[model samples]
Target: MNPATRSAFPGFAWSLSRQKTLAECPRRYAYEYYFSHNGWLADASEETKRIYRLKKLTSLEMFFGSSLHNVIQNAISNYSKSRKIPRPDDLVRLVRSSLNAAYIDSTRHYGLWFDKPSRYTMFRDVYYGDGLPPDKIEEIRSRIGACAESFPKSKTFREISGGRNVRLMELERFRTLPFADVDVVVVMDIVYRDRDTGRWVVADWKTGKESAEDRTQLALYAMYLQKLYDIPSIRDITIRNEYLATGTWREYKLEPIDVDNTLYVLERSVMEMRRYMEDIDGNVPYELEAFPLTEYTRHCERCNFKELCGR
Candidate 1:
């Protein structure tokens, strides 16, 4: 391992996903961010190679989430330009085509090994096997289609589409906020500002079940926005999560204390991660043993590194 690359302390960047990975399994975090940092090097260790392979793995649910997010983002972009929402059939076609191309790439180019069948293939296999049923596929399709159809009609969509009063802030772009200790990266699905009320809204698109983590994620976004724009208070920002699967919306008006608590939690988490990286002697590279596998065996079953961990 290049000590220069690996020993870059205090320059650590934090994201919600990265923090969650560390919290879920520190071993996985070390593999992802430390050991596999430069896995492409020809002289990479065997452990690095193994971790790199595990890092490249993706799940059917991830593919579906990405494709759905793309469809929605593209639809909004198109409507922003043309002021016309694509038909439900067109959206479905777009989703299926995107998934089909991803499936081909995953199987052929990446050589991703699936225990069963790819999600796209599973749609047809439902007739012959105990895989995902046809109705479930249709349900998913309908959910995405409904999200597309309803998005253009929502008040937030209208405000953003108008592009006059509530201007979209760096549509579908990831922005970073540098803190004293660590840099925080936030990729907001949609962020807009109401010119009249001088209020900013940071919106996230969710295709999965809501979790408490969602609140923390949004709180961080709101806090970041406050710092990024030099806003006087958290009350000036509203964080929203749009659940595409059910077309339900949840909004949070963060209080000053919320942002304070979020910052405390974030700093504490980063310090803990930093402690994991500290190596007093050169013998224990990455302190891999310190980061143990999760005690929850159920998480191991779905982990991409399951085989590597010999679970």
Candidate 2:
């Protein structure tokens, strides 16, 4: 493929979430990172284009999470410069409006997405679910309200906007640090110094319930931040997950051993992913059969590539 054909994709990059996807469903992962490559081209195979369309589907929860995170990301970013914090009510209103727009788009934008999959949104709800139920819609709105209310009022957010010496604040930008001969990508929600505590903070916002893997993900991020920015001590970094939907926060202080374990895990994860690779140097993957599909109906039921998998 020409460079222009691959402009939208990063070619191949390792990430904690991408690793999780590989673990969750290798077939889906292959479709995502490999077969769908160059699927966006005008002269691409029909099957490849269809695969790319399915790949573009974002579930309702993911859609909402991204929407809210982006809004809050911009708010914090603007506050870092303007020192004017956004109102909780305004954020809530914006989220509700966006939700409405997305719901309509999911229902009505099929033709547009068919013409240009990358330009328009393709929601998994409409594709897989045929759109969510009324109760589900209300539940999403309720969660959005809670998260929006919690953010501008949360202790961590308050301090960030409460006029402190914020430095090295990274938000909504993809950053990479070379590891094990691969580019490890991380899109950190926010990373900055507390200034008062003389500690570096990696704050990750959560829209849904907590996961056991969250600690590991945070640890990976913390390690990446430390090495990328050349922070002196590993213990000086603080990992936090702000559970916005519930208005709760938790912090994990990284010890030297934590960073060591994270690196070990990262190395193992990278090795596991390479098992399906046909060419490690070129970042090429093997045949579809090499990546087995999961037998679990629960996972496939809501998956975007269900049709392709014949789930």
Candidate 3:
């Protein structure tokens, strides 16, 4: 596709998240990246408008994950700059405050668009749900507190926090690697160079359950860094997923074959997305048929487009 046409669609760049969305549900992917591309136009179609609205949907789990990530990010950032970690209580307070703001924003703006509960409401339900005692709030607070406190004490944290042998990469920095015909975007949660071993360490903070996709995401980051720095081999990069919820860590070392597989997956994903968006006749409008709702009903359960799909 030409640059203009590519720019008109959502899968133009092959980020891991974009690939996952396309894999989970092409219709959802199209709604998010394709149809919604022109959603804000005054004369946009009803389908476009609907997809645009559904695209704004968020879950409590996502909010909680993002809030936790922010806390950890801030803690590390503070330590990296000042050589001091925030108190656990202060970190918990930060999480609470950030979550509260997000809750208010969701309730006031995006809550009415979806049939599901608002973020604030979901938080309350979980905090006060039946079959659980009033200590639910304390349980959550304790987990957040512990997770924050544990970060500064981790071996990896110590290595990258500040030392003569290591250099910290700015947190939340976006880097892109150009492949075949697309750019793969990756934003690492934390990355640093180990001067002693001449190795690059990349870590992503996760507050959710572990999944196979985590490996794929890390592999992509490794590939991007390799290309970005012109590293001689993928072996020089190490990937880690720091699961904050349970203070568990997963590490990965990418093989040349793994990088090959990651590239293949990305190329195939892009090809499939392009096939889904094929419009031979310039006169034809983008249709629901172009991106069909997934046959897998289970995926629709938590999908924001469930109501839109009449499920």
Candidate 4:
């Protein structure tokens, strides 16, 4: 262990994913770290522009998410219509206002995936699965419907917990210490205390489909949370995919072994990042990972990064 790794605070300093990325390739790290560039070439080719255009239509999917949010907000408002309990209507309005503000904030805001319409439609439609048996399709649709109906009322916190992007933890002994070295930080969606089990949970909001790889991301998040917060016996953690296209939410849990594996990976990543930062060799031009942006699944067609990735 590096001597600098020993902190008066018991938990880890950075999220595992952030550390992992830094270790994977320092040039990629520089782009993501200091520059805040997600490998996006603002001045893109015509083909990339076309793909971006098609992607814009998928913003239409927000119609489904906002429609359901409105429905649930209405339900909550009606539920509290008789009494003084708070409602989700304000939150819905706030989200809408923020999105509009973001649109206005952009200098040349065309929209998401502006170049690829058929790809967007095909991706969504296929995920909805035309080849499935009629009964199976109905069952899947019904599950999505149920999720749309139940999500706003289930395990919801009044306000997005931990605030916006970065959470602040006050170390009692380090009250006077200025945090100068900390540049990158991770923001999670929700934190839950199970009603029946009395266990702590960290829930991340995913707007895409769930996969085993997504579980790995959650484990990394959980391990960082445990290390940072000094929370122990932190067993059950989940990544909840609130699908925008289908108006559904699915939960994926992280097992103990997965958490341990992620931490092992994380520690090694941190050590490598520290080493790369100290390297004084000849200037090495930074290069983003070639496969890092590759379209691993059909879903890659929908990614905003697909054009930059040359997928």
Candidate 5:
């Protein structure tokens, strides 16, 4: 991976920052939000180093995601032109460039370590272990290379249009809402508006093990659409985790009423938080001490105030 020339979506305003901090650690939020303090980790610990390395790799994955998204987005845009979807080369180039940018960022962030054998050794041990032999590694590498071979044909694109990217219109209310202050926000990897059926469908490309919880998450997104956007035409929400390891796609879809009920739960959670905030003094000292280690592992894992919290 290479370094990023700039941060992703610079100047993107985020109300989720407070929620992100709180999710990381209430003490961290209290310190940063109330005290204006920035020293969160007191310099990088061993875990911090590990996290930073993982982040660089994650940045590379982000590039891959962006590449795939651009390819698919462009295909959607050009559906009217040439009666054909964009080629994979267009997206593959973007992915490679994005990966280069990731490398650049990692080089800057980790210095010489980005190129060090020690780093590679650590990454492979952590991410790959001994699961891959040399030939298998090469084979997998070739498949990734083949990702650039060709774009989806028109017929193929048409078939997949039902489960491709859905543009996310980030709503301010969604960000600042009492209960539904989403920690991370992303639109469905695929959303199709079926003109013939008069229905909207949502899908996400996933690359992990599936669980009932994953289906619930997709259902939750559907709930968001109905409650926040009032797009009552959404008939199905699907979660598909395509496993790269096994080359299999696992899918689950949500019923409309089930999604609606999920929205009801979200509404109640937000209303409760709203009521709680009404009685709280904004100027009062942030009571981080009330947060305990048993509450969440993230506090110990990421909070700069971990030492103080433990004290």
Candidate 6:
């Protein structure tokens, strides 16, 4: 597209989260992918603008995870220079301050966020449902505290902090994988070379409980490493999921079948996504009706657009 058209329409990009949203609810996906496009423009309809605001709503869990990720990135940079990992207590303080700031954004800065949704933060619970309960807030705090305490002491951390052999690639950075059809956007948390094992380590920090989805994420990261660094073998790379909250970690050396499976799943996801597009090459979605809502209302309960959806 030319500059004017580019400003008006968003280009297509495939992501794991985008695919997940499409699977979870087609209507929600429409609100997110199509309805919210170019919403920052002054000429956009009020509903379009509102949907854009809804798109920015961060849940408490999301906020916590983002904060932890930020700390990890900063800590990695610092360790690379100072040769010392950040103290766990310091990580706790950093998380607390960030949490406090997000709370203020949700509670006291609605007017600012309303005026500029992309600039300020608005949390889902505060907008769509009751504010976070005290116990829930306490649980978040405990989780943050645990993760902060655990991260600096993890076995993975010891290696990353070890020395010159440790080459950390793309800490919290967005790397594009030009997949077969569309550009696949991936922001992997941590990718590094193990100081001791001398193998590529693709790692992610988790502030929440483990799920099957975590493996899917690791698989994506592994593929990313394979392409980015020209990693020779799937078995050559060790993928690690560090559950900071539990002070535990899991490592997997993927087999050839794993890479094959990841390719199959990603190709299928892209194909399914394109099915909703009217002009595949032009990146135009079909009319909103083409994408139906999920049969399950349970997914809507916590969605920021629930109010707009009238679910």
RMSD of each: 5.1, 2.3, 5.3, 11.8, 9.5, 1.9
CA displacement after TM-score superposition, residue 89 of candidate 5 (Å): 4.7
Off by over 4 Å in 4: 1-28, 35-90, 107-151, 156-185, 194-196, 224-232, 236-255, 271-311
**Sort by lDDT, best first: what order?**
6, 2, 3, 1, 5, 4
TM-score of 1: 0.81
Clash counts for all predictions: 0, 0, 0, 19, 19, 0
lDDT score, residue 214, model 5? 54
Residue pairs clashing in model 2 are: none
Q: Could you tell me how far off, in angstroms, the CA of residue 231 lies in candidate 3 after the best superposition?
A: 1.6
lDDT (tens digit, per residue) of candidate 6 on 163-255: 547777754488677867668888787777865666888888888999888888898888878887787887878888999999999999899
Least well predicted 10-residue stretch by lDDT in candidate 4: 170-179
Residue 174's lDDT within candidate 4 is: 13
Tens-digit lDDT string for candidate 2 (133-221) = 67877888899889988998776787676677767564547877787687888778888887778888888899999998889888878
Angstrom error at residue 194, model 6 = 3.7
lDDT of 4 by residue, 1-311 (tens): 34354221122244544555444444334433423321123454454344334333323234334344544444444533443333445444544454344333232332332333332222223222322245744543454444443345454432222232322222221111112232224455455554454455555444335655566555655655666656664465444545433454556566777766765665565555555342323212233342234223554543433334444
Supply the global lDDT for candidate 4: 0.42
Ranking according to TM-score, highest score first: 6, 2, 1, 3, 5, 4
Task: Say which prediction, candidate 5 or candidate 6, comes out ahead on TM-score.
Answer: 6
Q: In terms of TM-score, how similar is model 2 to the real structure?
A: 0.93
Which structure is stronger by TM-score: 2 or 5?
Answer: 2
Question: After superposing candidate 6, which stretches have Cα over 4 Å from the reference?
Answer: 1-3, 170-172, 195-197
TM-score of each: 0.81, 0.93, 0.81, 0.43, 0.50, 0.94
Task: State each model's CA lDDT, in order.
Answer: 0.70, 0.81, 0.70, 0.42, 0.44, 0.84
Best by TM-score: 6
Residue-level lDDT of model 5, residues 129-174, one tens digit each, is: 2322456435434544454442352222434543544333323323
For residues 1-311, could you state the per-residue lDDT of candidate 3 as single tens digits? 34344444443566878888888888887666667665544465777666665665555566666787777777777887788856777877888887677556554534442333222333323222332234754566666776777666665786775565898876446767788777778878888898888989998887667998999999988887887778998998999988766778889899999988988998888777667655522212267666778888788866766656676
